[model samples]
Target chain A: MPPTGLEAVFLANRDKLVRFLTARGAGDAAEDLVQDLWLKVAGRMDGPIANPLAYLYRAADMLMIDRYRSRRQAELREQDWAEGQGPEAPPGTERAVAARQTAEQVAATLAGLGERTATVFRRVRVDGIAQRQVAAELGVSISTIESDLRMAAHALAALKERIG
Target chain B: MSQDRNSPMHGVDTVAIDWALRMADPARADWDAFTDWLEADPGHAERYDRAAMTLLDAEQALAAHPDVPVPIEPEPVRRRPLRWIGGAVAAALVGAIGVTAWQDRPQPYAIETAAGQTRRIPLSDGSVVTLAGLSRIELDHAEPRRAMLSRGEALFQVRHDARHPFAVQAGAVALVDLGTVFDVRLGQQTRVAVAEGAVMVDPKGAALRLDAGQAVTVEGDRLIRSTVQPDEVGGWREGRLAFDGAPLGMVAEDVSRFLAQPVTVAAAIATRPFRGTIDLEAVRHDPAVLGPLMDVKVRRVASGWTLEPRE
Candidate 1:
């Protein structure tokens, strides 16, 4: 039997969706999201929807945005603690040296990012702005905001691999 | 480096960063799906945590000396955001004195062993070293007993000295004895296995404190932690070579080392898994003994011995 249009879309882009979510910082969770997405599509879709791929991408993107929005405050609190807290030891201490190395590596990694991506990364990570807000201010769509964040994060992960 | 982009985790890193960035926002959030993502994979949360921790660390370092103004600052903040960071680091260093302690200095004394050879050397301190075959180590009798394993492996029976810690550096990784008996093997990859007591392993920026019967593999930037049987700590030194589903190629390498003869595997059998033990002393005289046991035909080539699949 010929696969339905929805099934065909799911088959073709399922791996791409996982890769997309994974690049976006889902890590292992990306697999689960894909599974969840599959379940959502299989269980709910009885009628034909126009542009299933776009709908799928939008649905996945929305799911991620919702996930991010759900725990936004606590994450912000942790970010404030990490960013605002003073270095535990005095200057030149071993802690400082370690921190300095980490800082240098992070700086070097961020320096290598694309100009726009770097700016987006800094605004979200350093300035602690919401992705939605960054998109609003920069006159870009939320999808662009997500993509930029993913690129920045992927770079940071590579940095960790280089130094960790 | 080539594998960095194509790695599966890179995709996850993006999602993790996305979530981290979103969480940092002041907007209201629903954390259930986020928790679901974290709970889905064992490494997902850990990777995210590391990225988040690194960001926090950079932030803390940048904010270290907010009061101390940097000399010769850039006029426009946007022109050089890095200058601000440099100023912060310099300000932090202003109060620091004699940071030379972290530099790597040349050690004075050295000990090395050849193929099929082992040595038990006593140090100035109470620590005793059992050097492995084809291993080299440099010794430093300073306040903290230090040794650099340049090649091969060594088993250390360190006496408890709280005032002076015993440390061994293997490549970028360092194993610090917190009063323990541990065997550290340096090769293509460094492996540290603790027999008795505990040891702390520092690989680049990450640190792991291993207890008795624990082992870790330090390969490049990755540290793989695993459990080790106490008896398996220094199995090679006991005249026994054991293989636990090890590749035939590696087995051949060990066989070569033990027999002091070149034992190369045919390309076809290189990856074949070999299990069971080879009594090195018994096989020392007849290198061909491995042929029957490994189910291979050992052919004595002009260059060395080659193990090929049996007909």
Candidate 2:
């Protein structure tokens, strides 16, 4: 069968996606990333996408982010092992400590923002509620919810930089 | 916040953040505009990536800290002090409310076991519940005789009391122990097998009484009754699963509980019936062994193993 919808877009822009991945520092793994992207797109049985090209790009970006996160986690694990910690230490002890610290830092940062902004962020991000639903429940406009999310994102970006 | 929005880097960062957020919801994202912005500036893509990463990290942190307080609306305050007679009436009302609240309190706690792990919990009533891997059972401290198996499998050895009988709720069906030892596996269907004594399946509904060595699979409103060997009722506890004409999908689900990785059957063969005893240890060592053992083709996927019919 001929490729259609997102699959067609993906095949047509395969080279562009590889270039995009390489530009995002995928380097040697760009081809592998593109393959992974193909698996994701091929398995999809959803309705027609509004902007197939843009969707592919965003999906590619997400794939890269996932790769980065997994790599970071592995590095963290290696660092823990290299620190000469005893092997008897329960698994995930270091992860739990790091997670607790990050959680506390996030709580403190969100506490500094407006109550509504912090609540909005928690309801949408932490609680996994939809943004539109959050706005409706909060009796605010969708634009208001967007602005609140933007503020939360800005604060979190600063926090990440500080943590790094 | 307004001052930060006015900064030189803010223009690009704000738009990038907006794009990142919009992209999260596929229905709302303007991909054409997003693509244009990315091509317009090399820096825009980088900024968007950073924003997305930051959001992801923040979400992970919040998730890890489950106790992070969510600010909910405050309760309404009472404006007037109670009069002497009114105070007595209010105190009586409070007492009634307290009793109701005590009885209607939420499920006190839940016990969950990860995949490839099992937990044996002995209740205050001398009943022992052995939960299978990848299973969750919710119990109320106030009521130890009741349990709700939300997912996975569990073996119940009840210290049956005629007055306060042990009841297990799996899906829409309720199994009340009639002085019995039974195993209930909840998945696409709820399967219950009695090793000893008897149990009433859905007293209010079908009210089917399953005696020793009797098994029933509850699917929707239908109850499929069959006989099982008394010894093999909860044989999974001994790492032995004997299926007699069981669907491939159900077999996969049962096997998946014993292995750290998931075992999934291809859609084409998902409903195919299989009759056999699978040694989980051998499959755990080499998932590919299942292909020859079950006379099917097993392909190793990134996440786990996928079973397919031999072509």
Candidate 3:
């Protein structure tokens, strides 16, 4: 079987692509995004492109834009929920009940985080402190703070999934 | 949403966390990678949303209680002011506006500052908070005189209120003011220095009383006591960062907070200690400009800027 155009592009620019993403602030997730891009190209390769390299970069760029937009909108919605002004479902509605229950579970999970981890996460998420600033305040490396936040986030995500 | 219950993308909690942190402090390079992750799989966006929502939910729940739990502090005494303030605020809003407007009232607000940006916030209670750059503070009016310092530094002038004592919670430590002017810096450790009057610092289970010219810093469960000068309180308010024999790396960190761009030090010069003041009034924000003042070489790096030993 012949290799697809995207496969060739990925083979050529995978390292460059990951480096590009990392420089942009993807942190450690750049590898995952690039791998996913490769998979996407491999799966959807109908034929060779006129400019495979340009196409891959463009595709990646578009993906990032879409993610940014959706994430911003989601943040606004989350803010609304936090302020208790989310779309009013009837008090007894399943969605409302579920949201309340999920919030409780998330709070419990957060309360259960390790002392240092919880403090770091609270400062960033609740106190709205910057991650770099938190690291400096704690006299730890920025990566350490990021990892602590990641630990809290993963715990909350697990709780969210479990509650669902 | 359809396909695999067992797929790896279905469980993207770590990736979501990474995205969250990056989004909070994104560089020019992060957005492209973020978009790639979002576009890479159907489950990725969903997981991110879930994680973000969960975090938001937890914050809201935690904020509802005026007395937030600290890692080492004993259980908080249930304060009656919470109930009283809830009713009072609700009543005041309904009386001033209508019930509908009061129902839609905003949460007790939070103010955040970018690096190099400072804000002086006057609370409803007349207490003043001078928030330094790269800092965050939340004012829950129901919690009234209390504020939470998440990161960075703040100089607080608490209006003397015996009925409702002013308190500031920074990470795992709590600072209760005894009618004083004080500065609290929330960094790797929490430092509380009283410029006038006194302060009671509760770190873990022990409470230490700090009087004027006294300061204490909490690292994990350990409390270190030290002396502070009155001039050192809110020194950043005058556009100056005074370091007393602080390491070069720590000095660089303070400078980074003052400038729009960050400056990283070479490992060799990171720990060299210096006791002096960096006058922000006279210097440009460039590390290269600062190198001469500090006896170092500042060079532009691909990442941003790096400081090295001067030849």
Candidate 4:
């Protein structure tokens, strides 16, 4: 079917909003969400949308609610799988620093490290992912991921030495 | 640093905490890159300050409990806002996801704001941003963890992203985010200020930083910083507006805020200078009359307008 004026409006906004919705845990549902909103906008043509962009944003937000419900279950599972007994440490102190076991305190110090180091640490400790998976996700060699993880560990240890 | 790793969409807090843990265990290649990152900026020291404090606390908590303390939600200061956000969240999820795509390209985060209200937002990549009033921040959540401070002010409690150093736009300044808790305010110019951490307030074309115990007010193209008391900067978080030797024109404008009517200033009083802080709303209701200064004259321009510099 040749696209209609209203359909054009729907088409125009669909791709753009999909990315917007993705941030709110709807990364996978951009398509379905866009379709649902198109129907409503067309149905409610009581008057032309004065500011189409604003209307489109308003509509996109509405679609996210349904998408969130469907996505929530998946998200909870994914999160649990990723986190472990990592840095739930007591705040950094000489004693706590000496006892350094929890991942949170270690993570805080890692704030000074580079992005890749932090990512490697997060994946290995918090997510319980293997070095290979971390490497693959970052598009780096598995050895590279392994190396980064080691360096982060050293930074944490060095931090421990300074304070502990 | 341009590491824009794919990251989580929601509940970034947990994701961030988790990542902090893994980074502590068996060192990885990413760690060496982090060392390079530390060498890249000077304020990296500030970034570690709070996290260091937290680390200290985590030690205490663990020593005492040997288990993760169940985080208690703070008592609600205002139920109305949360209820509104809850309603808005529901409505957006129902329809906003798609509409956003239709209007704007995919962004990391979609934000909505209320008049005279501010928010501290947590982005998908585990970075925290404090949003100012009437501002909208968009996040890409993709490689490089891109974000735009559409308008208003924001405080970025950025998660340490080595590959993708977070960035914020404060007018002419392209606030290149290092790991830190820094504030970006939208006004005559983008204001960059830091609290617990340091930030490189790179103005793209200029150089300035709004570091801890200091504030950088940028207007037009120039950025200037003045060292002030810590809480004096962004005091609104504590429900007060703090100012130090602020100009008369800006002070009066702030005083006349939130009224159904716009506050006016006459040419004579526009250039006068004043210094002090009072309740913004209270002053607007009953303005504290600015007594005359030798350098400038203050005159009543209209029923509510004040004119400075009677020249």
TM, every model: 0.42, 0.44, 0.42, 0.38
Question: DockQ, per-model, please?
Answer: 0.10, 0.14, 0.11, 0.02
Q: For model 2, how does the per-residue alpha-carbon lDDT over B1-311 read when each residue is reduced to its tens digit?
A: 11223232421255556667888865577655555666665565556666787788888889878786643322122223212312343244334335554466555799999998989999978999999999999887666777889899999999877666677777666777877789999997789988766687765455666655557886655676665655678788888898877899999999999899999999998998988788878877888988977889998899898999899
User: Could you give candidate 4's per-residue lDDT for residues A93-134 as a string of tens digits?
Assistant: 855655444444554444434456566656665555777778
Model 4 per-residue lDDT tens digits across residues B90-125:
243324234433455544556856545667766666
Ten-residue stretch with the least lDDT total in model 1 chain B: B73-82
Q: For each predicted model, how many residue pairs clash, with residues at least 3 apart or on different chains?
A: 15, 0, 11, 78
Interface RMSD, in order shown: 13.4, 17.9, 11.8, 17.3
lDDT of each candidate versus the true structure:
0.63, 0.75, 0.64, 0.49
- Give Cα distance to truth, residue B217, candidate 3, Å: 2.5
Write candidate 1's Cα lDDT for B1-311 as tens digits.
01121233422344555555554443523344554665566555445555555455444544553332222221111111112212443233222312342253634788887877889988867789888777788875432266778887788999866555666677556666776789887655577887656687761235465655556766555565544445567777788776655679877776666566577899999989997788888777787888889999989998678999999
TM-score of chain A of 2: 0.71
Best model number under TM-score: 2
As a TM-score, model 3 comes out at: 0.42
Off by over 4 Å in 1: A1-164, B1-107, B141-144
Q: In angstroms, how far off is A17's CA in candidate 2? A: 92
Candidate 3: tens digits of C-alpha lDDT, residues B1-311: 12323343333344565565556543312545565666666566555555555566666655554254444432222222222223443343235434444455455778999988889998877889999888999886544566878778889988866555676777666666766789988764467777655676762235566655556756554666654444566787888777655668777776666667677889999888776677765544445667776788889877567889988
How would the candidate models be sorted by lDDT, starting from the highest? 2, 3, 1, 4
Residue A17 C-alpha lDDT in model 1:
78
